[model samples]
Target: MASSPLGRPTRGTTGTNRLRRNDRWIAASAAFRRADDPLVVDLGYGASGVTAFELTARLRRTRADAEVRGLEIDPVRVATADAQLAEVRAGRTPFPRDLRVSFARGGFEVPLADGRRPAVIRAMNVLRQYDEEDVAAAWRTMATRLAPDGLLVEGTCDEIGRVASWVDVRPDGSPLRFTISLRLAGLEHPSIVAERLPKALIHRNVPGERIHALLTDLDREWDRAASLSTFGATQRFLATVSALREQGWPVLGGRTRWRLGELTLPWEAVAPVAGP
Candidate 1:
């Protein structure tokens, strides 16, 4: 008999467009845009498979051949998503009848047939319930399933797509970068993302931690840029991120991405310092 899916059931708290920000990130990522196969996996897609459908639709804008496979450890969730996919195929749902999407029972193990490997595996909110100590092994298990040069995006977000953060892990199971994406409108502080950080860094947001310092410095710059608010939140955020880069934060991307309320830095920027 096949081995059981290697994960616990998700809390199943899913909503429409909850992962829109993440989808946009993946659509633009090199792993998906440059992949020869363009196969993406939406691991632990919670109660609804809508995320997978939405991801495929968004990615199709960039790569028409992009495909998404929604995986869930709970067999019930898989069945539910499959049913929803049938509706899409019958043209009863708003999604494209030919939406390149499928549903399967899986978890961190990411079982796939035909020796297929995904260009990107998005595991949002899947590890929030796991212990911090369990993060590395989980990342390794999932990352090993990726195609060469593939990416493993693991992170957490709120119910809405407004606040999100993810870590880009290489196929070798090592983190490459950390990114935070937030809605800039009426934003209180950039550190608001601390609440939704990936499991690996969530507990590390304490004093003396690199992540804590990053958030602290980010909040400070946001306040300093408050004078630019009259220009608009996007402009204010642009200034904030620019300041961070000036202070040698190793911020990645340029104004085009900063305009979208995104900030990416090498994982070392906020990686947890080794423990005693």
Candidate 2:
């Protein structure tokens, strides 16, 4: 298929399991697990198809019939992923059961053929290279490719996939929630995740903005909950989240999510400001 040109090409810096956190969260999300067709799009999956493959494997556990498509603006990266998948298939070496993973050349506009709108379009690290002003445009372009009930998971993360933050967007292109996930074992501060809270929220993590206020509160709460560190950082995190809840920050989810080093808040809490 002809690749799109809505967005610029990227360096395609991909590594094995670099998107594991986003994959795990996507599979667990209601938008993905109960999709009408279980079709997912892995937008800008870098130079390899491994992340797309992993996304299929993890999502299949919940949907059982999940399919994944990795979209890259660069035709070369798409071809490279296709070659990797072919090599794996040719080997027949007991690979992770991926009945549905494909590579397509596309961009933020997602020029998918057959009118095949995916139920989930996960655009990880795709907007990092663009100006902060371009995020909403990118989100609009991506969300337009979704099914009526589709979701758009857009975010950024570190190299090794230890920490990530994404915004769950509805088909109408409005962001629903913001989530922050961390490695958590020896975590220093829960607010450290502010650095990875998707491109939209990263620079907005300063004074006055809602995201900034949220992080400031989180950092304060983390310090207050440090007493619980005697038990473990996980416990301290839980306490901090609980405190946020008490503060009535419209925090969503609970211990079930907190245990995974995750904290979710509604979109209004972190939407970008009007101007400088």
Candidate 3:
């Protein structure tokens, strides 16, 4: 991999399957499923490379040749991941022998060798440390390293991966959609997703803002569908999302995805606007 100045190191907190929700979403996305070149980047995959390994395993379900390159700005973390890679390669791990994954030192610049631009770059929880104003520029840097039709999935999630949300951005740095993925088993309300919103929308979740309005509406609908909770959280969420659509909330995805506690909306629907 090409070298670049290492960015500031993060706390690098990570765990196995901590990013399963994000991984599943990427597996279902057209950008990932239809990529002629299935190259994915696990940007800033924290102190451990387990998430990257899980991402590769999940993605391989759809594309056997899927390639996942975990990038970390911390050389120590990179070395750790490289050691894991060595173990996997030597048949000392459970990973497939032909697993196409690697670890390298890089940051928002994504310094890949041979000018390789990935089809998907999942930068989860990496931007929380930066100022909100710096998010756009960081996004632009990553977007510029993508293929023509590539995507940049950036956002945050809880440690155990119960509540998750992310923005799907194009190579030009324009967000296409925002999706919230929840565990739903004990979900109180969909508004809880506000806590895990992408930096672009987290601060925007306030009175009179589009994101706030969306969450408020979701919570209201979720409560309205409380009667369906007797059936199950899945049914309740389905009803709530259905109500959102009926109320003109522009909910995306079908029951198949809704069953997984996911709700997506066009970015324009919740994109931050000027003012509170």
Candidate 4:
């Protein structure tokens, strides 16, 4: 059952391109690649709509016909985002569709204007305020609203978007992959991500939990690969992730993403947190 819960309104502390890492990942993803109808939703996109506008611009590079919509529960926020996107409708934003990007007032149920399903729902920081126990049903509620090949990239990141971790969820409401993206240079430990983990894993970082063990192992491998830092943080991260895979960890994504300070593991590696 969908929790009879509407997430509390956030502080709306937003800025331009704050969700760039996740946007880039989605734009180049397998789902977006095969999508016939490329509509994206920036759910609860805070006080400013700049991130929604930025998502449209980023996704268009791969699929020029792509469109992005920013959804918010606040009617006032919807009004503001709509007005900002109106510039594109006026042919002033150098964007494709006249109203390619629009805003609507809706909660997690996604009250679309004309009954539309989105290809991707990038709900960044939306779940941070909810109780940890509410994360799964919330995921199920949003995933049901996706197009057949849709994706739900739900996760959290810091204010400037430097460090982020998200789970790529499918229509079945099951997570396919877990990605931890960080600015490699000064990245002390991969486990630091536990602090910024989505509402799902944030509380699961304590001892005896799968997430804790995962981070502990990552920190160990990072230390084991420390000597490789002279080649650059990217190289060190690549080596660290490679080591994890060799040690029988279920790390899934490969070198291309590792070089970007991202490590993707199968959902099972972190699934115990959500287990009874």
- Top of the candidates by lDDT: 1
- Sorted on lDDT, best first, the list reads 1, 3, 2, 4
State which candidate, 1 or 4, has the greater lDDT.
Answer: 1
| Backbone atom clashes (below 3 Å) for every candidate | 0, 0, 0, 0
The candidate maximizing TM-score is 1
Candidate 1 pairs with clashing backbones:
none
Q: What is the per-residue lDDT of model 1 for residues 245-268, given as tens digits with 9 covering 90 to 100?
A: 999899999999999999999999
Against the unseen true structure, what C-alpha lDDT does each candidate score? 0.93, 0.83, 0.88, 0.82
Off by over 4 Å in 4: 1-6, 87-99, 273-276
TM-scores for every predicted model? 0.98, 0.94, 0.96, 0.92
Report the Cα lDDT for candidate 2.
Answer: 0.83
* Segments in model 3 whose C-alpha atoms lie over 4 Å from true places: none
Question: What lDDT tens digits, residue by residue, belong to model 2 across residues 1-276?
Answer: 653357887678787889888888888877776678889999888888888888887887887789998888888888888888887677653456345889888888777778888889999888877888788777887898898888999988888888889899988777899888888888887677777777777888778788888888888998999889889888998999999989988889879889888889888877877621
On a 0 to 100 scale, what is the lDDT of residue 154 in model 4?
A: 93
Instruction: List, residue by residue over 74-158, the lDDT tens digit for candidate 3.
Output: 8899999989888888988878767899998888888888778899999999988877788888888889999898999999999
Every model's Cα RMSD, please? 1.4, 1.8, 1.6, 3.0
lDDT of 4 by residue, 1-276 (tens): 112325666678797667888888998797787788888988889998888888888888888788887878777787887787777677776554443677777668865656678889888899998887788888988899899889999999988888899988998888878888888888898887887898888888888888888899899999999999899988888888888888888887678878878888878888765441
lDDT of 1: 0.93
When summed lDDT is taken over every stretch of 10 residues in candidate 3, the lowest stretch is 1-10
CA lDDT for candidate 3: 0.88
